[model samples]
Target: MRIESVHATPGVSGFYFDDQRAIKRGASQDGFAYEGDPVTEGFDAIRQAGEALLVEVELADGTVVRGDCAAVQYSGAGGRDPLFKAEEYAPVVEGPVADAVTGREAEEFLANAELLEELTVDGDRLHTAIRYGVSQALLAAAARARRTTMTDVVADELGTEPAAEPVPVFGQTGDDRYVNAEKMFVKGVPVLPHGLINAEEKIGSDGEALLEYVEWLVYRSRELGPEGYEPRLHVDVYGMIGELFGAPYDRDEVVDYFAALEDAAGDLPLQIEGPMDVGDREDQIDAMCDLRAGLADAGVDVDVVADEWCNTFEDVRAFVDAGAADVVQVKTPDLGSVHRSAQAVRYCEGTDTRAYLGGTCNETELSARACAHVALATDAAQVLAKPGMGFDEGFMIVENEMRRTVARRERDRSRAAEEVTAGD
Candidate 1:
């Protein structure tokens, strides 16, 4: 079906736009410390209700489908900043942008959105925020047009079955986040631990500091939860490894650092993310490949994840093809289209690389839930639960969506089984 018209409006979100680069040095939430000393922590983040470009698409059949846009703060890891204002997204959804996209087939919506990004005068593309907002709107529209869920739409496009197990929920917290994680663990919720990108600056991205944080996470989960086991650890250095160990990366030093972390982590499986934000895509491939090789030489079993410069479909393939990372965090908004994100996941699946469908805490509830559908469809390594900078709200929202989605899938399967039995 063709889109008859597309309209946009101010939408509500359960998150905020935060510039961690500007956050002040102060501790909040569960005894975790924030040292913004390097960048001069001059500002504090306000957890205000965020805004989304809520798109309503009317199909030729006169049916309406709804979708919304949400983005991570920090300027899309610095690619495009639509300069999101409080009232609405900086890239207003209207005019020729809408006109160019209207009356297009739903399946063509993503490519058409890319065309809009390209056709913008002066070679400046629309902010990645707008791309995400618009493309997902079309995908949602496509799914509705087929009378199916977004997850089903993705499965059809990617030729994959929905994962039978509910997508594992990955949640991060420091300090008091333990209490929150403990509560969920007690209820048989398998909430995994994700340590922030070196938010503990006092230890200076040292392995010891991460060990302290992981210990707290493991101890709390084991002590409080029914399962007497440690949560798998994913530590996001956020490129602070460069701050600790200088660039022009020393292979031995890099291996040593991971070796230290491996010892500290003991038996817990360690997944390291953004150990270094190697500048160019070429450099990133080289550095990550060397690290991957170095870690193997040093007998470190760390899973290296690439996030920063790996922003697009091409970027993801480049990293995966080069065997540069164990997992690539498909930052949702950076893909410009959630469908492209699905393609990225499928691409990773087809290769040796693993996909971690992740966004930032800056995302809203709508985007997070939408990502839930994407994660379930692709069977990503794990989906980052977001919309909460702290441990509680975002975790609740994401886990609830997973549970609901699985329940729906189970009921569908049960009916299918019944039909077969009745026919027999």
Candidate 2:
């Protein structure tokens, strides 16, 4: 099937409740808040409306593939977006890639992995994002065309189905100390600390607040111990703790941080998100590697998860090749297409490293459904479904849809088996 059309739809919405004081309380204590303006940049306020991307691609057989692309702000110091802008690649979607895909075999479009990067000009993040949206739609269309579930397509491609066990879900709730962890515990999703330790004017440096925050987390974990739920807690440094400042912390300091987290979580498994910053690439990698080593030396059974530094398959390979991370956080859009993302997952198969299916806070139903397929397509250890805590209702809707899809697939399989047995 050749590519028939590539287009985007943009919408404005907010994820946070409209209570300003409550928002401030949460943001100040947790170091970040979901409330903010929709404009892509500038302004520090609770509840900013934001835009989402919807893409549609059609094939020669009149099959239509459609999905959403969510442009969300990364919730940390960098203030950099996750790079899902639609306008950045409007030309390619409306131009050459569109031309190359039109009337081509659907399989060929799916199989031609290099077309994404090749069609992209300047290798901008937007190109990758648009490609991701289109690819997801195509995968869904391909699944429908083959009368198969997206998971089956993935299983066929990967050569093995992912373990049937439900992957654990984790949420970054700013600071775990402020929220009722019991609510999340009841929902069966563990808590991950949003990487903001210092946002208050008098908080001095973030390091100081981070240390205190970790201590508080430990106390809360102990308090919840009697509830028969020893929930695991992880830290998302989000490119904060590293050896780049004038007075960089040594490996021991890094160990100390993990130790504090361990104590706080009652020795539960820890996952460190990232140490990636804009210009500190070398130092960040060194610090992360050293931090991993320190965790090993201290007998801390923790996993290092890469986010920013591992945006694509190449980055994922580089992280594993360098031994800088134990788990690679795979964001669907970051990898451009489910096909390419599946390849990255395959690359990690049979290795000690694990993959986590991460979420963008601004996702809609289309993107989330596609993401579920991608998750099922890979052997990821965990999946995060936080679409800004119910603001992006589509996120939750897609998750439910995925669950239903899985159930339907199983039912169909069972029916087929019964029919075969009756025939025999």
Per-residue accuracy of model 2 over 40-145 as CA lDDT, tens digit each: 2333444445455566777667777776655444422222334333455455566666665555555543564446545645555335556666677666666766
In terms of lDDT, the poorest run of 10 residues in model 1 is: 38-47
> How many pairs of residues in model 1 come into backbone collision?
1
Per residue, candidate 1 scores C-alpha lDDT tens digits across 1-424 of 8888878777655555544443322333332333333231322432234556777778888887766666665442334354454344433567655777887887654466556556563356666667777777777777777766778877877788887777877776633445656655665445355556545453454546665666665556666767555566777777666556766467787788888777766777778888876567888788889889988887889889998788888889999999999989898877776877888898987687889998777667777878888899998888887876676777788888877878887887899999999999
**Model 1 residue 307 lDDT score:** 82
Error of 2 at 164 (Å): 2.0
Model 2 residue 288 lDDT score: 69
- Report the number of the highest-lDDT candidate: 1
